[model samples]
Target chain A: MTVSPTRIPEATVARLPVYLRALNSLLDSDVRSCSSEELATAAGVNSAKLRKDLSHLGSYGTRGVGYDVEYLRYQISREIGLTQDWPVVIVGIGNLGHALANYSGFSSRGFRTVALLDADDSRTGELVAGLKIRSFDELTAIVHEHGVAIGVIATPAAAAQAVADQMVSAGIRSILNFAPMVLSVPDGVDVRMVDLSSELQILAYHEQRKSTLQPDDGVVA
Target chain B: MTVSPTRIPEATVARLPVYLRALNSLLDSDVRSCSSEELATAAGVNSAKLRKDLSHLGSYGTRGVGYDVEYLRYQISREIGLTQDWPVVIVGIGNLGHALANYSGFSSRGFRTVALLDADDSRTGELVAGLKIRSFDELTAIVHEHGVAIGVIATPAAAAQAVADQMVSAGIRSILNFAPMVLSVPDGVDVRMVDLSSELQILAYHEQRKSTLQPDDGVVA
Candidate 1:
């Protein structure tokens, strides 16, 4: 029921949410139990890997009866600290920022966007997902007011690092960056980069390999 | 110079793009040469891991003199197949899709958005990123006309699986999915998920640990 955060491997920590999502879908369908193979299929991972990842949190499915879906879901959620409310601030109100503001998953998963901050003065007072956009200058006040611990940066590359520096100064520890730049933060501050361009390039890398291997195939009209 | 795709590990394949980005930044600054330590810092990896990864591609930097920035950049680019053009299709013209269409990284890094498709008829005439939105029915024709091998699904969760199925049927072998759902695909098709909510959850997990470890340390005024 209790596992220290340090005990779980980083890769396993990343997949915890995926397992949580799979368990949520199972719960919605009124499924009370599931075998490791079934859960693994839902999570898009091999059953052996899934079992190993779950073992880190002391969750082992029964020999023949499998896991109790709701129980496992709660255990994983608690281990991931989803049981507590996490106040967040999103900076930069560009297209990606709009998408993040409208994302319903955050609210459903214990994250509440306390403020949407943008450096542009014109963006202030604009409404997004029921929260009014505020100026970036107000970040310190907003973070203090809402006790925001996590920040999201959807700014362009040129402005990402400055925004991250401000977030750190404002006492924000976790950053979910959408910019296509590498951000440097002090140790203990976690920065997760969701580079859209890099992801596409990765897919392109594999696609190229496939085409080279079968140069004559799929020559469509 | 020709290394088979199967020879590279999946983790290394993902990091290659990051290395390419770092090298690009160096190239922009007229950095003709760099030590492994410097390149690894820019790429946000340790020098040992960077050296090991580059070794897999038969690239071993000269002792003391380090690597030629341009040469290493080209090598990584060629290895990742960034020298070629890759046509891509984006399905769903919502906020996230609009963001993807406007994203400059894709076009700059070998991915060309051939078409934008939407299920709603009303979105057909709307122009996004200089390309007019088209009906989802035109997917097959667009895929064939452009020989698009990669697809991006930004539709809502309920529609993501159907869109993926359509992409697969239309001959798309790789998919970058933004919808918050588990997509089931056939053997040959590759699916990469960019779940925004899940990313936030991971950050929250770490943030929670940070707060618990230092409770009452930052009770800001």
Candidate 2:
């Protein structure tokens, strides 16, 4: 049966992935039910916040009881469109691209890396974690054959835009960009950046502030 | 003179890195001062939210006059511990680590990838992005000599834990992990993970939802 759009908030949508991971971990342990507090604790979030997040998915838990681990997992998974497999293409077989190619998380969910493409002829025939690097010319054919809608750009900053342009032309509408540059995608396409140093800089900012605001903690450590 | 303590919320602390990056861009363009509205917009955040975030660092901006671009930049840089360079050790000389070693952001942010350590001796003599790879056994000595407090674990999931364990023994307390596995760090140490596929999976969830909800948005091409 088809499901209607529930109009979940962006904030709630972002947290769904976290909850889903936690649920899967719990399921691995054979957990049948989990209270909001329990699941939230395991997920490294507050119970109140966890319940509020789940409320966006139309109240899957009871007031007195908690939630069935598998049921909630299924609900969130379906809502996230993970019930079906998503074939993906990776452009730029550099260091970051190699890591993405060998990444276990992609294969964990229904996401699969259908092809690995690189413009460099030297890397084209090299084997990376079992997948032989292919040339960028095969992007369109591969995407059409694999029905790839998700494209990952792990190329260097200089080549990011070119890869993104080619991806869009090949009917790739969703892009996960690792290049430390701002990508301007068209209206229908979506781009998400995972900047490594940026995340560390953020942590450093907090650590810096913590050193000042809580002198005792820093000194003792 | 030593700096006094100042309190900053965890959420605000996280966004400080983003603000710093945006401000640096503005500075490179020779922009002097910016209102919360302008700065927030450039940083992909709202004015009110940005103001609230800045407020945590104690009224750095004038109520009506906005913030001095250079002063705020310094404040944020200092807050993120960039006033002093942090020496980091990368345990993997693979593709992602190589990109990071050559990345301009780290060199600019007072962070140096002091040494590249790998488990394989054959990968040892090879130079990547200018730095030569060394054995993982060198992690402790290099950390001690360079006073490295932050370490990056870019090895495969199977080897990430051993690398982290060695880092801790070397007195490194902050870690930026790019491995896909869940890391269990000892108390008092902080670990941050960047999973490429997880980010894509998250974006895919949103992209799939968007396509299903707005099927009327035809392929313009």
What overall lDDT goes with each candidate model?
0.89, 0.78
Quality of candidate 2 docking, DockQ = 0.41
TM-score of each: 0.94, 0.84
The local distance difference test score of model 1 is: 0.89
DockQ of 1: 0.54
Screening candidate 2 with a backbone cut-off below 3 angstroms (N, C-alpha, C), the clashing residue pairs are A95-B95, A205-B80, A212-B5, A213-B6
Off by over 4 Å in 2: A1-5, A30-33, A59-66, A121-142, A209-221, B1-5, B30-38, B58-68, B120-126, B215-221
The best candidate by TM-score is: 1
What is the lDDT, from 0 to 100, of the residue B140 in candidate 2? 81
Model 2 Cα lDDT, one tens digit per residue, A1-221 = 22235566677777788788788778878988989998997676789989877877765587677898888999888888888889988888876777678777788888888889999877787988788889999999999999997998888877998889889988988898888766767777888877778877865654454445554555422
DockQ of each: 0.54, 0.41
Which ten contiguous residues of candidate 1 chain A have the minimum total lDDT?
A: A212-221
TM-score of chain B of each: 0.93, 0.92
